[model samples]
Target: MPTRALCWFRRDLRLDDHAPLSQALINHDEIHCVFVFDTTILDALPRQDRRVEFIWHAVAELKETLRQQGSDLIVEHGDPATLIPRLAHRLGAHAVYCAEDYEPAARQRDTRVAETLKQAGIAFHALKDQVIFAKDEILTAAGRPYTVFTPYKNAWLARLHPRDYATWESKTLVSRLARHDDTLVMPSLDQLGFGDTDLCTLRLPLGTSGAETLLKDFLERMDDYAQTRDFPGIKGVSYLSPHLRFGTLSIRRLVKHALEHGGDGASTWLSELIWREFYQQLLWHFPHAATTSFKPEYRDLAFENDTARFEAWREGATGYPIVDAAMRQLKRSGWMHNRLRMIVASFLVKDLLIDWRWGERHFAELLLDFDLAANNGGWQWAASTGCDAQPYFRIFNPVTQSERFDPEGHFIRRYVPELATLDKRAIHAPWKAKVLPAGFTLGRDYPFPIVDHAAQREKALALFGKREG
Candidate 1:
């Protein structure tokens, strides 16, 4: 009897540099790859979800890659916890292997899968692949998770070894993959109860090949990342986020590039990567933070929770140029600039006095690169409700933020074309413009300011200040 194993692909989508899959290939005589669409999650998403389409494209490529290797990927639509064990038994596999997922929901799913696998006398292995350091791997000397980022980052950097980022080799062992004669058919998006989204129309690339293309492009501009990353107008930042999100690109490959380059730009980029791990660890240690404020006092902050303003914010008709541009960019592209993410989040929570969860949930629905940890961490940081968050009093003045970061209004004009003719000075706040472009009328062509920032800032301050600490 052959020592067979099932290599379950989830967040870690690609075959190359895959840790658990590589480990399985190294140890087992025959390895079968599988990916479950996980209807439990998909059923909750919108019909025309970009993420579903993106995953569909990636999965198709993955299946083809395995087929080219004389192997096959069993793509199924159902709960992975149930599907995995059934497939393991059907394939007569001795074990199942996959990368560890840190999100609370994923942890629960994996736990159930592990219990079922154990009942069937099969081994289950979850290896770390996504991050350089996972939960409790980079903790402080006191044996506690560091909530503060700088110290946590320093600890992470201090503990780092070259071995940590080394690529896991599996391609050389492709012959170990289980060769099956059965014809494998991948299901269409419609068949899976999902409509095709405009994911192809966007610039975002899919799968490992696409990730490689993006990385090659980003490497050229990496040296200037520190100087240019904040500006929304120019091609400053690496757009490899979606690839990173789907595990099309290995975090190790990216970290290696950042370290080998050795500059402020690379260092800054690396810190951002570390921040990702920080949030992951935080989420693991404090799952409650996912649904409520990390700081208990601010959990019940008196937010106005104005639905009308939120709707306006969502539609990008808020009459604040930068905020509107960022929101519209997200609506149209399914991606938003990092700086703009902060600005709009602040505007949504502080300026509009809505709950941070509102903006976080909205981002989760729209963002192609949305990760639970990053999105939640970012929203809480903007709203001053999470660990190491910005001070509650520090509200972003949208007009000034626009003037400073998008001084030329290049980004604003790209999405909010109504303000294209306005001068750089006036483009940041078209409602306050002394003169309007011919045929354009405030509140008619463009909306008047939905809520006064100055007035709302005080309300926001009062909202947070009045919280019973």
Candidate 2:
């Protein structure tokens, strides 16, 4: 009797360089590909979610690619824990395979699915694919997970072999993809309970082909990434993050490219990739960090969390041009430049004295490439509550950051156009301008700084200091 397997696609959306998909194709005589819309997750999200739309397009592309081969993708919209077992049983599959997801909730969901699959007598296989190294793969000499990133990154680099980054050849075994006479029609966005979003207007390249387009373009500028990445106005960074989040591009392929093309830029870029794995492993080992401070001592620090102030910050009327611009950019587009992300996050936690979780949740709702590990890690870092966070006293001066990173105010003007007429000097801190633009009244046109940074810095310090004491 011929063996049959079901390859479940989750975060790992692409077919190439896939671990479980390739492994299934090798071990099983026949394979069926699947992607569930996962209503349990979707029902909680806003009706017009960009991530859902992005996934839809990516899934459609994956389906087309699979259709080109002898196989077809089984796209279903429902709870996977209930659906996977039924699908496997109906298809007469002996096993199910999928890429490993490290987020706490996802791990729980996978556990449930695995138990259900086992009850149905279907073997469950979850393979590593999202990161170069994950879950204690890079640990200290004492065999403990590294809390700090530098040592973790060093260990990660030292342990890396060419085999670790080698491409998993799944396409070669495409012949094993099971051909079914049933027509594979994808559900419409409406059918999936998601409305159309501005994803198309954002012009983000979708799916595998899109990832390739961005990778090619980024390679041409990768040499300058280190120097220019901080500037939001420049095209220094690869816009391949969405693809990375969705696994349209393989982590190994990126790591391999960075390793082969050695330079300060590539090394810096590679370190970022390493940081991603570091966060992934951190979350796996310390799941509590997802909801609370990574450092126990910082957990009880008091935050104002003023709802009106938070609304102003969210609407990009914080009266701090740089911070406002960053928030507005996130509001208008589903993404923000990384430098701006840090600046805004610091402003939210330190200047406004709000909970980092508030900003984290907002970003979770908005970011096109929001990964739980990265977003939570970043928020904690900015809030000075994570394992390797910034010192609590070292609050970011939004004006200073803007002048340093976006000197010309090109990024600010792009998003916060109300300040466009202000000269570069005033653009960063328009309220402090010697003379406002003829028609631009400070409070009327743009918000006054919601809180005094100096006073708030002292308050933030006291808040943390009291807790630490």
Candidate 3:
């Protein structure tokens, strides 16, 4: 039998720019690709999860890609620890290779899988393909993780070299793909106890093709990214976060594009990508941040538990136009603009005095691009509970935010269509409009602002004060 290697596909779903796949091809004559629909993870998600559907579709596409290359992906539905080793044993593969996963749960799962493979006398090799820089690659002078982003980013830039962005060229190894005597089968979504979700409604294309489309589109508008990214109303931002989250797009390719041809906009966009890396490292260094505040001093900070208010906020009836619009957008698309994400997060924790974890949990449930590191980083940053967070006193005025970012209320109108008839001036604050639309009333139609922003701001400040005391 030819020496066989198992290429276990994780987040890095695509065939191109894949380090593990390239490495597997380099060292082995026959490469068997596999993807496990991890039940340990899927069991916790809602049946209608868009993320599940997205992954399923991406996997389907990848399997097809492999099939075109005269190979088939072996799809399994079970715990990865059990499934990976079992599959490797059955295939009698010499080694198992995969891309590294950074999330706490993922790290744990990978560890267990590696141990199982080791016990079975199979070498497990994990390559860094997800993020450009990971785990102590960019550190402070004293060899500690940098809590702040700027210095870390600067160091990351300084450490950057031409070869860092070079492609792994997996295409050269396509000939090494294992061909089975009989056709390998892919598990149906229902076999995994998952129902068909209307993910197509979101219009998010799946797999490498989708990533390429979004990247190409973003490159055209890369120059204006900095200028227009702040405005939620404009089509200035790249909708590549979901792609990045799934590793459908390679980070190196993205960084290379931004550096080589991307102008000012690309530079700004690249920094955002670096921020993602910073957060990933943060989570890796401090796994406690998953449950507790990154800044320990803020962990005991009081949060008001107003379920009614939180419900109103979640349902986009908070009466703050920008906040409402953003909430509605999240509900509809399972995605939100980065600027608006900060605004809504701040509104929940600072303005409403709610716990940041509550908002974080909600985002994790709803966001298609939900990665624990970036999600936690963003929420903590907004809540003033993370390293390099905004000061507690720096609460966003939702009305002012609406006026600045959604000046024409285009984003607002798109999500909150009930306020579409209102003029631009009144759009941000429909409750304050003297002459309400023919059949509109604050309490009846839109609902009043759940709590007075000024009152809640003071309450949040005092709560933090008490915690400090």
Kindly list the per-residue Cα lDDT of model 3 for residues 220-287, writing each as its tens digit: 89989999999998889999998898889889899989999867898899899999999999999999
Candidate 2, residues 127-194: lDDT per residue as tens digits? 99998788878878898999998988888889999999999997778999989798888999999888
Give TM-scores for every candidate, taking all chains together and pairing residue i with residue i. Answer: 0.98, 0.99, 0.98
lDDT of each: 0.92, 0.92, 0.89
Those runs of model 3 whose alpha carbons end farther than 4 Å from true positions after fitting are none
List model 1 lDDT by residue over 1-469, tens digit each: 6699999999888988899999999989999999999999999998999988988888998999999999989999999989999999998999999999999999999999999999999999999999999988877788999999999999999989999999988888899998889888889999999887888888677888898989999999999999999999999999989889999989999999999998999999999999999999999999998999999999777788889999999999999999999999999989999999999999998999999999999999999999999999999999999999999999999999999999999999999998788889889988787988888888888899999999999988888888733
With a 3 Å backbone cut-off (N, CA, C), the pairs that clash in candidate 1 are none
Give the Å shift of residue 447 in candidate 3. Answer: 1.2
Q: Which stretches of candidate 1 lie over 4 Å from their true place?
A: none
The Cα error of candidate 3 at residue 76, in Å, is 0.2
Return the lDDT, model 1, position 78.
Answer: 96
